[model samples]
Target: MNDNDKQQGPDNGGSNPWMKNLLIWVGIFLALAVFVTIFNGPAQPAATSTIAYSAFLDKVEAGNVRDVNVAGEVISGTLKDGSKFRTYAMVQDPELTPSLRKNGVVITAKPEDGPPIWQYLLMQSLPFLLMLGLAFFILRQMQKNSGSGAMGFGKSRAKMLTQREGKVTFDDVAGIDEAREELQEIVEFLKDPTKFARLGGKIPKGALLVGSPGTGKTLLARAIAGEAGVPFFTISGSDFVEMFVGVGASRVRDMFEQAKKSAPCIVFIDEIDAVGRHRGAGLGNGNDEREQTLNQLLVEMDGFEANEGIIIIAATNRPDVLDPALLRPGRFDRRVTVPLPDIEGRVKIIEVHMKKVPIAPDVDARTIARGTPGMSGADLANLVNEAALMAARLGKRLVAMAQFETAKDRVIMGTEWKSLVMTDDEKRMTAYHEAGHALVRIHEPASDPIHKATIIPRGGALGMVVSLPERDSYSYHRDKMYADLATVMGGRVAEQLIFGYDKVSSGASGDIKQATKLARAMVMQWGMSDKLGPLQYEEQQGETFLGYSQTQRHNMSNETALMIDSEIRALVDGGLARATEVLTKHIDQLHLIAGALLEYETLTGDEIKRLASGQDIGRIDSDMKGPSVPAGGTSIPKTRRPKGPFGSPAPQGA
Candidate 1:
């Protein structure tokens, strides 16, 4: 602590804060006493009425007057029936006293022609005093919030995090373990810089966390704050910018000044790409306002005037567009990649979220995690919350496996639309279409296991067939890509075979679009085309950030472009031919699965397998079998209608 700080103590504005408060209250009490004394007078009578001067004289002559209090020329009085009245006499009433005396009415006169000298002085000075008090209060506020007052746009808006509610530690965070590990050293450096300084290893000036949105970058930063036990200042890069020029740069300077004051602290700037994008990327000069802000940030991070104890931690999903100067060795010496959680990380995340909710015994973290590939920590948290809401909606005390399934389905397949009515023929066609996808996926060795297939409308699709990976696949092989292409084309191929090409509906538009894109990626980018010779013939169609896209160089001629187009077409057609062959061979099994879907409207992978092998899956014909329930069970299909007055489920099969 500095000598000045130690000498001042915590008294702030005075030597003794309690004594200062006592004096303030004393002043307020004296002011209130004076104000009341100056304004105090006789209270107004109940229900006083204003009457004309002639009526007042008539009341007096009729002997209806009870009593009156007169102040100056204004008269207020009550009648014999206990009603009150008041009136102003513009001129002197010489006969009023005579009439009152004759009628035996009690009269009290109060001379209010002018106020006392002291009261008059107070009344006129009270307004000025109020204005002075307001001015004093404003002055006090200005002194405290000097740099952050109105017209102080240059002041930094960074908030100092308090360790109260919503505080997070390392134990609170799950997934992105790699990024968390990379940031732990930052916490160590903040807690005890001597641990590293002795070894000649000064901590990095800044660490940049690069990740996809919702991948827990901010959580990692919060964890550091919780562990470091030091001042933590958080601000967004967008907060530094303003409508006026030079404001963003000034804010950057003020923010660094704050961080330096609380040395050995952590400053987290979220979405730094907002102000640190590549200079001149936009339609402006190099010295634009945002560019100036970026320049200031760059200098403060690694300038001649050292920021010895301030460690900067910036998080952005768009690291590709950030200025290169911000990523130099003296600035962001470490780049931590917080990728989407893998299977194990996903299980940990699910378990972390599960702790916050009431989970039934039926809930399995591994099962949920295995089904959710590439979900970020935020996504898993949302999934758990949705499941809890679903359970609450059903009045269930705990979030069971059923709610989790519904939540996952809602996230993956989009929202279910049970009210979407389709004709029997349309339903049958959709069943056949999805059945083909399920059958193809099952037959392809390289394909992932089919999780579920339903002819029920969800999102924009009349039917959906979802496949879940056994484990998260890091990279796609040629065989897997081919299998994906065939699976995507299965619906279209099925429609063409059953409802001839001439009668095929445009329901396969999505499938066609997906297939075309995948095939193009494979041939043009993945080098899966023999003609393309295992080389990237086009831009990678990779992450586009900051509205920046690489200008397509004419690396290939028009002939090569045609070849690329042909290669993409060939790949797609090959997938279609493969699907056609597979469906042709399993036409009988295809018919069986389609019939099952027509009756049930949805089937899980296990159910499809059991039914395809000729097992009854809860069919109402006194034949079908389902493991979840018995035949004619309470479990109802999506498309079933009421057959009787009691709303019994339909027994008819399409």
Candidate 2:
């Protein structure tokens, strides 16, 4: 933000300069009232004491009264002794004035003394005027909080950042480099339109940013504001609609009008799908507030009167549900997908956030980035922040690689829940379950490399086995899918084999859920079922503008449903049988790995392999302290996104 933004002045915040000046005027008027009361007050009687009327008459008879002025009162006079005193007289005292004249008193008559016309008016209206001003002030403040003067519902809620907490220029943004480049070119063209116009090139009227959450879509828009020396308006799509019927359309019109005023500006509408959803999804009456708002917006963007010099930048994660008209060539023609950053991009993101913390010389961002696959730019930033916090908690001088490793685990799995204590039998059962998953994965040739195996409780899982893909894959092959299913099922199989059929605990609940999801997606969505014969068997739930209570029905007949169910059951049963066979053949190796886990509580893939090979893992007595965050197994749910080529280590468990 530049001085221009700062110069917009504080809005709905701090003290209003106009209000401050009004208060000063109020103070000035109050001081004037005090002065008027002091100078334009009733004239004093010039008397010290009240004397009886008879005494005044006696004084007049004795000729003690020298001069008197009857102001419809007794009189005011100075005695011959040069001492002044005053006394009240009867209003209908006809003898008073005559007595004064007979006594040879000097009679004086003058107009009554009072304040001037302007001063009198000022004093009288001061209270009413102050009250009126205070009422106006209260209304004005309420208008600021409520909306444009009392009925501000029609005014645009699109907010212009009067002042940003900190400026975010293009230089600070990292990862999503391609998306950044696209936005930068737009800002560059805006900075000098003639430069690009020389080639008969016109900048796109709108650019839609499509990305997963935390992929820096909004941040890219803000960076545009920082790079371009033009006005930037921001508003959420949800802000346009209200309960009032015509309010949303009015807001759309008002917002565009404002943009027209600030031409050559960027207006960023966040979550545009909220209002730009497929029109027919709402009330079919066609007069729905959100639909009307969308219609107005569509018209304003590319309608009869072209909104020249205005650019709309909108961000949304769910672009599939947007209306067709909203995505046409004339409006939102440039679609920029901010994909999850690849490993190199992730390393760069880490480096950017690392600059804010004190880092040790040995800290390698690439190592951390490699370990933390599928992390978006926002996630990487959080990782750095978490690492710094972890170091601080440990009272370390600087953040170390060890802290980053711990932080990555914490972000993915969760911090170590040290409070839960397990009996020896329970711990052994957990070890066998995790070892079964690891061994099953190792046997599957197409499966990813085992990253680690741990029996330590993390999140809601007693133990977990994790895998590390050498490179990211867009789609899974059948062999790898089977491997995943078998590995997840291994826990239950191992429990059945070692602890007997009835002794299996609920520790395999997550494993069963993961396997079911994988197998269902394979049979229904991926067409991996041979009996389904590559036919689509399941349809998605009804499309919703919002999560309304839409009925979810299966169009398939009961026999077809039975076949689909049988197919899913067969796949799961096969996975379980395969796991059971693998464990039965490798019983000795299973006990070996479980023994290592029981001793050390956690083991990396390399250590587990060493145990299986009967190699001396001589570091047993040294550096065996568990990490602050429970190191997760690779069996965590992997991200299915086609881009990024990174792994997802969610809280998937054995």
Shift of residue 6 alpha carbon in model 2, Å: 12
TM-score of each: 0.79, 0.80
Clashes per candidate (backbone, < 3 Å): 7, 5
1-654 in candidate 1: lDDT tens per residue? 742343234336565756765776687678877777677744455587789988988888999989988897889878999998988899988888888988999989976446767778887797689668757756655645635644667889898775643668988888777778888888888777888888778778888999999999888888897887666789998998888899998998889888777676789999999999888776676778898899898877766222277888899998878878888898889999989999999998899888889999989999999899978899899999999999999999999999999999888777866555566677777878888888888889999998888876666676788888898888899999899888888887887888897967777777888889888888767788887888876673433544856635347789988988899899899989999999999887777788777766678888877766656554353344434333222222455632223221111111
Backbone clash pairs in model 2 (N, Cα, C under 3 Å; residues 3+ apart or in different chains), count: 5
Q: What's the CA error at residue 137 for candidate 2, in Å? A: 1.7
After superposition, which runs of candidate 1 have C-alpha atoms over 4 Å from their true positions?
Answer: 1-147, 303-308, 540-555, 614-638, 641-654
Each model's C-alpha lDDT?
Answer: 0.79, 0.77
Predicted structure 1: lDDT: 0.79
lDDT, candidate 1, at 71: 90
> Stretches of candidate 2 above 4 Å error?
1-120, 142-152, 161-170, 181-185, 303-307, 545-554, 621-652
